[model samples]
Target: MPSVEILSRIQFAFTIAFHYIYPPLSIGLGLCLVIMEGMYLRTGIKMYEDITRFWIKIFALIFGIGVATGIVMEFEFGTNWAVYSRYVGDIFGSALAAEGIFAFALESGFLGILLFGWNRVSKGVHFFSTIMVAMGSIFSALWIVIANSWQQTPTGYIIEGEGLEARAIITDFWEMVFNPSSVDRFSHVIIGSFLAGSFLVMSVAAWYIVKKRFVEPAKAMFKVGLCVATVAALAQLFTGHRSAHYVSEYQPAKLAAMEGHYDSSAVAAMYIVGWVDAKSGKTTGIKIPGGLSFLTHGSFNAPVTGLNAFPGTERPSAVNFVFQTYHIMISIGMFLIALTLTACFLLWKKKLFSQKWLMTIFIWAVLLPQIANQAGWYAAEVGRQPWVVYGLLRTSDALSKEVKAEQVVFSLVLFSLVYTLLLVLFLYLLNKKIVHGPEMTPNEEDDSDEFSKRNIKQLQA
Candidate 1:
């Protein structure tokens, strides 16, 4: 029973949250494809080829859904956020156009060859196609993150005129692309995508192992997935630290809310586990005094700005939302790091495949990255509340004037129904694919022994 504006905002959030699920999957899967296909070429291993082919089906399915959902979001900008769109039209046009030219074209051009060209082209040619598709996915993330980070930081833009008629013009394209928050956020997103992809691959492989089906290829997938997960999880720690530093420097209000810093402090404490009492505007948790100071400023007693620096109206609208979601993301990230690193150690010890309990945990571990990704996104978007374009424009002023309450309500209901159906369809298709597993070519089956022979020492177990 919110007002029209609030309903519209909630509607958009719901649709976009649903849509956000696919891109990371596709992006992560793309990198896995590259790794698998590249290994096949280098080792001429049918096991690698099997992993590559099976995941291509998954990759294609995810990519299709991502494209579909992304299109819906684009239309929404014009429909629900018309005024905001006009204000940043030039900036969006440039970035989106670049995405199409650099990302979509490459992905689409090579995707067909990657998907359907196994029998038609040379192995080298097919591998090249996979490379392009992987690069394209990363490129897509780059431009999109750059655009979003611009909103968070409002860099390299100059506003002309005043009020409803004002527009922000890009002063320097490169500056805009590398805004204060862009590269840091971009790193976090890219690493998160890799983790997502790795976890998916790991989950399926783990399930196959537990079921005692597709043993060899599953081993191959699990090994490669472990590699990606371990490396990406470690990288995320670095990227996360840098991202937090940037947020602390440039978005103190958001940082304050994220850490639940209510009072001004020369040395800020980081909450390891915490919750906020929204009614009383008080934070409660066990925290390490000055832990945040060390993490963000490289000193235990460094001055860290707090929420009191911002006025009540300018503060984040949902402090609990930011606090809880950020902590969830951080906790999950640490868990992933520990999980992957443990798997890595066991793999080195050649005891990984025998660990049934661990495999069982990994079988359902795909959901962790999904949760972490959503939590991270929630922390980011909610922390930036009130501002649609940082300080340039408040979210209330960005709504389209022509859209009616009833129209938004109707659209929200319809979209919810359609999206629910779509979710069911997607899950059905994905389950069907997982249950069916990979189809090995006749040649791969014939060459299974040779392929298995080429699998390095670790996979020999």
Candidate 2:
């Protein structure tokens, strides 16, 4: 039989990795829907309306998958991490409740209006629904980050008693919301969402450009995506910098592990690229000297703490892998921002679309931001070593006591197989929708007219 620790880690990793595949798309698509609807409103263009409707179909599909996978994660909290739940149930329960009440309800509610009511509502009203859907996504992210930030910084909670009877309770709601890491982390993540959505739009547009199809629709989508990508990319950089500084101050060990520095020193050099050797607690490969200090403290001579400062038991090895990976992710984000901005400038100067090479690069650039978003989340969650609830309980102590290693392994394998099938099905469906494109007849206006007639009859009653 596999060890209990191995089984638990496997289950957690499988569930989380599956859960992640959907939310970023949902969050990003929410903004894209808003932009599409707004463009239709401004220009009274039927093609824009058609494109919006087409993408919304895909968004709805993804949103449903996101909700389904997300629900599974909650159940695993009770099943796989029962002990952890019992310990921080009060804190997480509140944050989760808020997510349901504030984010999920708003999202699902307006989603009905945005999707089905498209035909039944007026232009202005339909536009408002799209805005609400976007707001809902942002609200959803806020509560989730609040919960995760608590895990990282762990504020406004008190631990009472000891052993199996121990519990962590919330003392202040606002304090929890405005936790030290919450704001920067939230901004960085939300901007990443924007980047994801913008690039997806750009990708589809690029496909159209290559095929020389849907010229007007593709151009409009590309322009909107370019603007969003540029802004989000810039904001992400700034927020990432701020978050790194926050990590330096509040979670010095994580900061140290990320840089792979074994000893504390002033003017620490950041390794822009490297392979970390866990046994020696050092990194090898390419290095950028003095960059770490400058990035963390905005000074070349600022003292940066190292891994040796922490107790042997407290140091996390695999967590450092996540840290290093996050830097690579950020570098990818920076490169995309520069490349997209340059493309945008060229497009504005009427030189971009004509260049086949540039168009080819833009077509394939969608994957970069997606990688960065996933990597950033990995860094945040993995960096909080030992503690599942940050100072309240260690992960080793928070696993299910009643569960057997064999049972957990069985379930882990089952989950992986099932999730793999579901992923394949989802991808197939998504590709079908993309390849079919928007239908020409029975457009958004026609749908709206039919809805108005039905509504008038109801009003007469």
Candidate 3:
């Protein structure tokens, strides 16, 4: 019971991490489905139609999981954080309701058509449904990002009460939606989602290539996945820079913790890699000279805030955790960029699918973006620390007082068991899909003998 706070936090984090895996995937797959179907419509390629069908199954699977796990998060608010829920109810209600009405409705309405209407509906109509579903997924992300960004940099709200009764009231809904960090963070997240989605596609395709299953289809799928991955990984670099600067302006302490800046300096160096020593309050590692200062303030000599600027209590509780996770995310992102570029070059050379070693690396590399995405979220949330709504609400004060430590501990255990089962099931099913590979039509099956010969030669070579 003494560890109730920790238990509750773990419970929420565990459920959220599991839930998070799917929505972003569904979002990415939603777009991928759009692209596949669009290509089929444009080129009248039967192969594209086959690929569309294949990925549609994967997308639907993740979408269902996302919904099932996501419901837990919704119920969690009232159960674990009633005080926080009541306070942000008005603001969250608006965003979530809009998502339900505008996003979910659009997605649900068209999902049926998208999954089932290939033969029944006109191609044009089905294409329209795919587009709608993609748009809905994006709009859903938009609202959720807006709500979270508001918490990061609260605006357009006023506190209407005191003590336990205090609540936020909207002043300008648009201002709330477009809060200070919203745009930058939103861009970062969607691209990260896309990056994860592309990784998933690439990993599966990579598996197929290495295992000598679904050769031509896997090659085609890998091409689309690589195209998406390369573009997204590159775009993230620029978007990440913009988001970092936004953090510098709005949440200096969080940024300070992320970069392991211990003391204010005009020529702050960004650690390319480092470890933080909490006892000594120092970070030691090889770092680019003046890189952090330049990125944060647009000049090498520009001053950057350090943890010392804020009281110790105001800073994130887990500096090492924040610092390590933030840097690990960056390291993975950079590695992915390099990997994608190299893959692009190999693709141009017409040797992408032939490279057994590269394909092997890619099969495992798909999990990198998921780790990076979760790390980014952990850094953002933990670095915000102490505060649940930035300057307005402390996290401790936001807890539901009526809930006891024993209850929270029990619920955490229950959630852990449930989530563990879900993870096992997801892995089993996903593995089955990958091993099964895409089913080729009779004509395509006949056509693959030549394709198989081509791959056989590559394997021999």
| Clashes per candidate (backbone, < 3 Å) | 0, 1, 0
lDDT of 2: 0.79
Measured against the true structure, the TM-scores of the candidates, in listed sequence, are: 0.96, 0.92, 0.96
lDDT for 445 in candidate 2 is 24
Residue range 126-153, candidate 1, lDDT tens digits: 9899999999999999999989999999
Overall lDDT per candidate, in order of appearance? 0.87, 0.79, 0.86
Query: What local lDDT score does residue 179 receive in model 1, on the 0 to 100 scale?
Result: 90
Ten contiguous residues minimizing lDDT sum, candidate 3: 447-456
Ranking by lDDT: 1, 3, 2
Tell me the spans in candidate 2 whose CA falls farther than 4 Å from its real position. Answer: 441-461
Ranking by TM-score: 3, 1, 2
Candidate 3 residue lDDT tens string, 1-461: 46656767788888999899998888877777788788778777567788788898888888888889999988888888888898898899999999999999999999999889979999999999999988898899999999989889999999998988999999999999999999999999999998888889889989888887777778878888898889999999998999998888889999989988888554678998899997888899999878898887778887788988888878897999999999989999999999999999999999888899999999999889999999999999999988889988888888888888889888888888988998899888987887776766555545443344443454334
Better of 1 and 2 by TM-score: 1
How close is each model in CA RMSD to the real structure? Answer: 2.3, 6.0, 2.9
Candidate 2 local lDDT, 1-461, one digit each (tens): 77786678778877876787677777887788888888778766566688898889988988888787777788788887888888878888898899889888888888988889877989898889888888888898888888888888888878876898788888888887788999998988888888888888888887777777665466667887888888888887789889998898888878777777777565667877777787777677677787888888878777788878788677665845775777878789879878888987898798877777776777888778777877777776667676676666788898888888888888888888888888998989988987777654343324322223432343234
